[model samples]
Target: MTVAVEFIVNQLKQVLLEEQVSTNETVRQLHGKDESHHALSLPDIVVFPRSTADVSAILKIAHVERVPVVPFGVGSSLEGNAIPIAHGISIDFSEMNAILEIRPDDLLVKVQPGVTRSQLNKELKKHGLQFTVDPGADATLGGMAATNASGTTAVRYGVMRDQVRDLEVVLSDGSVIHTGNLAAKSSSGYHLNGLFVGSEGTLGCFTELTLQVYGIPEFVTAGRAIFGTVADAVSAVTALLQAGIAIGRVELVDEDSIQQANIYNETAFAEKPTLFLEFHGNEAGMQEDIAFTEAIFEDFNCLSVEFEQDNAARNKLWEARHSLAYAYIHAYPGKKLMSTDVCVPISKLAETISYAREQLDIAELAGGIVGHVGDGNFHALLMLNPNDPQEQAKADHFNEQIVQYALLRGGTCTGEHGVGIGKMKYQSTEHGAALAAMKSIKTALDPYNIMNPGKIFT
Candidate 1:
């Protein structure tokens, strides 16, 4: 180990329990990378911090020693957001997994950085409430907030940024601050909550979070609509929204994805472009919405429509949709998954998705298109042999093409995934002069660049 890192590690050991500070290769390797296809970069040491004070101590030592510090949760980030690329110290928050408070009457909950979404929901179920951001994976709330993550439910309940009401963050200089309060709405100071939520751990480390929650929908139903082509399916989504139908969740999966899902999930679903759908409301209201949805789908040339009203069947239907990524991973045994997403205006979703499909075909890569179409955001799941430079090059070109198209159409290069190393190159193009302001803020808050360096800005 470098003498500098060794000294910093020794200092951390003084403040934390010996077991909490680790240089074991296995532990370091685990904290080094995330779920992304980016090459793994190991940190020199991994530390477990149980409280805000523990985090403060670690950052203070790192700031003084000029050692890079990366905050890590369950490591489910798709764009390598948790990877400690500079190889300093990785602060794993697993030991801090705790639900600090749950105020159902006020529709808010407080949690430590390590609490996963599923874990929080299990406890909230007893209160007849649910946290609405479902990014598929049972990702930690801290990580989700860092990336501003959203999923199928985002169309109705909003993304992680909307759910986060406050954050207890530790700055690089070991100082702590709360970004917001429990108030439902505010015109107070700067929107620190919004800034910190998508900061990707660059500005500060989140020790605790206060988030909004919602009561369980009175009635819910799930269904799928099969279409002849992706264009038809996407157009159907636009029509549904324009007609003011309240859709709880609406996802579009192309034919290739369906084929993989069938093989992986062992289902007999038709191999065609389809829309998996859900509705939330009173029983009578849901029935009306479902009827309207079916009619609209039929008008858009939907080949067939099926609904699952039973709770078990509804869970099974959505489970298959959520597992689509794993299906691609399982099918490509020797390849790694490179998932990319973009968001476009609802009016342009059909054309943008069509263009994405065409580009995927021209690139001749093995990937599938799926999206949360209700909100005009979609992902292309590409499987590439990491060892093959030529294949990786082609995948890179494919991703660039998609990103450029989205930018030209007033969309973001990354819809939900934060600007980790994978999306860093496109930040300048996406933000233009605003990126300069972001850099200034980063410099002001993290002058030493000790907090998750080499991210958001290249």
Candidate 2:
């Protein structure tokens, strides 16, 4: 072990319980990588903190020793957000998994960093409530907030940043502070809540989060509309958004992705470019909304539209949509998943997706296209043989092409996936001078640069 890591571990052991720390090869390897294609580089040690006070102590010692500290949340992140690149200590928060408070009347829940989205939803169901952010993996709420994650439902409910009312953060200098309060809206000083939500743990570690939740929709409906081409499908969604259709979730699954989902899920969905849509509202209002939505789908020559009104069918339809990324991952056992996401304006959706298709063909890469088209954010799931450097290069080229298309059209490099190591190259091109301002913020907050080093900027 390195001198720095040994010193930090020795000091931390004095305050942390014996079971709370580990240097076992198996444990270090487990915390070394996330779901991304990034290679694993194990940290020297892994520590589990059970509460905010424990986190505060860990940070205090790491800061004094100048040992880099990486915060881990189940390691389900798509980007390399949780990877401990600096060979120091990886703080796994699974032991802190707790639902601290559930306020049914206020539509809020206070949870620890390790609490996963599915776990929160299961609990919320008892109160006739739910957390709306649904990233593909059952990622932790803190990880979701760090990466500013959103999924199929973001078209209506918004991203993780939108749901986080407050964050109890532990800074590099061992200070504990809450970003905001429980109030529904705040015009208060400097929006710290927004600052910490998508910071990717660069500025500090999120210890606790008070999130906004929603009551169950009185009625729901889902539909699968197939189109002859991606252009036609994207254009139809554009028309629906233009006509003010309030879709709870509208997803686009391409032909290749549909085939993969069918194989993994064992359900016979048509292998066509399809748009999976859902509607939420009062029982009396949904019928009219569904009718109007169907008419728009027709205007763009929807090949066929299938609606699922029963709860079981609707849930099953969404299950297929949610499982798409995993299906692609499952298709190739040994290949690493290089999942890249980008967002463009609603109008440019068709061409951006078409350009992605062209790039995939040019690179001769067998990639899957799936997206939440209600907004213009989508992912290109590329499977790369980790052993082949040439194949990895081709995947990189494909990602560059798609990102260039989005940035040229005033779109973001990432919509929900935060700028981790994978997206660092495009940050300057995407943010320009604003990126330097972000650097200033980083320097002022974590001047040591010990918090998740080699991320975001370098």
User: Candidate 2 residues 1-458, lDDT tens each?
Assistant: 76866777788889999899899999999999998888798999899998899999999988887878899998988778889888788999999999999999999999999999999999999999999999878999999999999999999999999999999999998999999999999898999999898898898999899999999999888989999999899999999988887889999999999999899889899999999988999977888888888888888889999999998888888888888777877898887788889999999999999999888888887678889888899998898899999999999988988999999999999988888888999999999999999999999989888899988888
lDDT of 1: 0.93
Expressed as tens digits, the lDDT of each residue in 162-232 for candidate 1 is 99899999999999999999999999999999999989989999999999999999999898999999999
Measured on C-alpha atoms, candidate 2 has an lDDT of 0.90
**Weakest 10 consecutive residues, lDDT, candidate 1?**
1-10
Count residue pairs with overlapping backbones in model 2. Answer: 0
TM-score of each predicted structure versus truth: 0.99, 0.98
Q: Residue 137 deviation, candidate 2, in Å?
A: 0.7
Top candidate, metric TM-score? 1
Candidate 1: stretches off by over 4 Å: none
Give the clashing pairs for model 1: none
